[model samples]
Target: MTKDPKVVSFERTPAYLHHRAMLNRRENNTIDALELMRHAVERSPENREYRLDLAELLYEMGCHEQSNKLLLDLLAEDDGPSECYYGLALNQLGMSDVSGAMKSLKLYQKRDPNGPLLGEVARLAAELTLYESMNRPVSRRLYRATRIADRACEAMREDMPEKACRLFEKTLELASEQYEMRALYAMSLCMVGKVGEAKRNADLAAKGFPPSVRALCVCAQVYGILGEDELAFEMIRRIEDEHPYETERRLFIYTLGEMGLDERAADCARLALQETPYDRELLHVRAIAMKRAGADDRAVAGF
Candidate 1:
C-alpha cells in the first residue's frame, strides 16, 4: 500500500491534509482529523475542492451551520453546473429542510441524471420526507442540535476536555431551551471536575426541560459525581419507574457503572439480562461490575 506523494504545491495541501484526516478518522481519532482538516484549510485557501471537502467533513463531524455556510459559498461560485448542487442539497438536509432538500435534489438528478450519488440522494430524500411529515420544525431543530452535540461528544471522547467544554458551552448557549444540550454541557463539566457547575446545570435542566430521559440521566451523573449516591440512585430509579426498554435499561446500567455504583449497576444488568439474555455491550459492562465487586466467578461467566 504505497501512499500518494505529499503535495508540493499549495493546491495539493488540502488533499494532503484530507488524506491524513481520513487516516485519523479511520482510526477513530476524530480530534486529530479535525485538527488536520483545519491545517489543510489554512494551507489551501483558494482551492474550492479543498474548501468543499472541509465543509463536507465538518458537516459529517456535526458542525452543520459552519459546513452549510461553506457549501453555500461553493454553490454560489461561478463554476459550471457541477456537484455543488448535491452538496447544497445535503446541507439542506442537514438543516432539516426536507422540501428545500428535495427541490435541490431533483435539480441535482436532472443536472446529472447518471451521477453516482443518486442512490444516496434518494435515500436521504425519503428519510427527510418522513421526518418533515412527522414534525417539520422540531425535526429541523433536533437535527441541528444533534450535529453540534456530536462534535462536542467527539471532542470529549478524544480526551480534549477543555475543547469539549467550550463546544458544549457554545452548543448549550445556541440552544438554550434544549434539554439534551444542557445535559451534555453538564456531563462535560462533570468530566472536567467542575462538579458544582455541573450540578447547577443539571438542576436547571431538570427544572426547565420537560421530563426528558436524557436530562434525568444527566442528573444521575451529576449527583454521582458530587458524591450524592442516594440522589444518583433515586435519579436512576426515575428511568426505571418509566419502565425503560431493554436498550434504555442498558444505558442506565452503564451510567451507574461509570459512576462507580457497582452493586446497583450489577443489579440493573442482571435484570436487563433476564430480558435480553445475551446483549454483548451489557454483558461486557456487567463483567466489569462483577470484577469490581470481587465476584470473580460471575465476572468470568460474563465473557
Candidate 2:
C-alpha cells in the first residue's frame, strides 16, 4: 500500500488569508493586500487582531473614515491594549480631528505613559494651536458660505466625506463665486468618489479667483487620479515654481509621496532636506522612497 499524504485546506482558515495579506503588504502590493484583508475580516468578524490589521491598512490607504470607525468600535470594549488608543489618536490626526486626537492621546498616556508614540501625539497636540487660523468673515454676504465651508472642512477632517460633500454643496450654493471654497468642495467631491465633478471643479478653479496652494495640490491629486498625468504634472510644476513657501513645499512632497512617484518624491525630499536638514517628515518620506526603490533594510533605519 502507498503511504497517504496529509491533505491541507487553505479555504478553511482566515489566518491563512490574513498571513497572505501581510505578505502582500510587505511586497507593496497594496490593492491585493487590501482585498485580502477585507476577505479575512469578513471570514473572522470577531477577531480583534484581524479587524485591527484591516483598519491599519485602510488608514494607510487614506480611508481614515472607515479605519476610525473600526478603531473606535474596538476601543469601546475592554482597553487592555494601549495600542488601540495610539491607533485611534493617529487615525483622528489623519482625519484632522485635532481635539479628538488630543483627547485620544491623553487616553493613550493614561493607558501607557511611556508609550513610544507619545512623542508623536504630543507633537501634534502642540502644533494644533499654531495653525494659520482662517480669517473670519469680513462681509455679511460671505458669512453663511464661510460657516458652511468651515463645517464641511470639519466633516472632512472627521472622516465624514459624504457629510463634508453635502455641506460643501450647500456652501457652493450660498457662494458660487467663492473659488477657495469651491476648491475645497472639489476635494470633498474627490473624497466621495465624484471624480468627474472634481475634475470639472478643478477646471473651474483655474478660471476663478486664484486658488490657495492647498487647492492646487488637491487639484493635482484629482488629475492624477483621473489619469491626466500631464495636467497633474503641470499643477505640481505650478506649485513648485509659483508657490515655493515652506508649507507649500511640504504639501507638494506629501502629494508626490501619495502619488507613488518614488523618484520625484525622493528628489523633493532631498532638496527640502538641503534647506531644512532637521525636518523629520522629509526624512521619513526619503526613507519611504528609498524602501520603495528596493534599497537595503538599513537605508530606512538610517533615517
Candidate 3:
C-alpha cells in the first residue's frame, strides 16, 4: 500500500515552504533543495534562518566553500545555533582545516551544553584521541590488536599469501571467534594453498550457522575447492529445495559450474538468466558453458 504520489507531493510542498532545506535533505533531493533555498535567500537576504538553512544544505551537499562563507556571514550578524556551529565544524574538517574545526567545535560545546549530540561528540573525541595516539611509541593493547588484524587484512589485499597466513596466526592469539577475521584468515590460508586448515575453519563456520544462506554457500564452495564435488552438490540440492530464493538457487548453479559439470550447470544457469537477465556472473557462466558446447555465437552474445 503505497500512498498517492499527488498527495505526498502536496503535503511535502507546504512543509518545504516553511522548512525547505530540512525537508529537501530528508527527501535527499539536493538539487531542488539548492534551488528552493537559493531563491528564498535572494528574495529575503535579511532572513537569517533562511540563509543558515541554505548554508547547512550546501555543507551537506559538499559545497564547503559556499557553506563556510554563509556560516561566517551568519556568525558575524547573529549568535547562531549549536547545529550551525557543528555544521561549520564538520565542513572545516572536510576541508582539512582542523584549527577552524576545533574553534567551531568549542563554540558548539558552549552553546549546546545539554544538547542531544553530546554522546556523538564524546565518541568523535575518543576517535580523534585514538587517531592522534596511533603513531606514538607507547603501545596500547587495543592498538596492538587492531594492528595485528590490520596487517592480516592488508596481506590478504596485497596477495602476500605467506605473510597473510602469519598475520592471521597472530590475529588468532587475540580474537579467534571474530567471524569476519576468521573468514579472512581461512581464505588467506586457502590462497596460500593450505586446503586442510581452510576446510577446518569453513566447517566450523558452517556448523556455527547451520541452514544459513551464507554459511551453506561457503561450505558448498569449500567442498568444491577440496575436490569433494559430490558432497558439495548434495549441499546445494538441499539448500535449493529448502530455500528457493534467487540467492540459494544462484549459488547452486555456480557450484555446478565450479565442479565442471557443464551440461547440468548450463540448465540451471539458463533458468536463472531468464529470471535475472542482468546478472553478470550468471551470464559469465552461461557464456562459458555455451563456448564449451561449441555455441560460440551464443556465448559471445551472452557476454
lDDT (C-alpha, whole model) for all candidates:
0.74, 0.79, 0.69
Error of 1 at 44 (Å): 50
Give per-candidate clash totals.
0, 1, 0
TM-score of each: 0.52, 0.52, 0.40
Deviating ranges (above 4 Å) for candidate 3: 1-154, 167-184, 241-255, 279-281, 293-303
Off by over 4 Å in 1: 1-143, 294-303
Q: How does model 1 fare in lDDT?
A: 0.74
Better of 1 and 3 by TM-score: 1
lDDT string for model 3 (16-102, tens) is 563775677689887777777887777778787788788877777656767888888777765555667777877787566665776
Local accuracy of candidate 1 as per-residue lDDT tens digits, 1-303:
999999775555667887898798789686788788778878877677667767766666645557767777776767634566677777666555667778888877787888888787778778777876776345555667667787998998898878888887777656778776787788888888998888888877766535666677778887877888887777777776776654466567768777877887887877877754434455677777887877878456846
Ranked candidates (lDDT, high to low): 2, 1, 3
Highest lDDT: which candidate?
2
Task: Show pairs that collide, candidate 1.
Answer: none
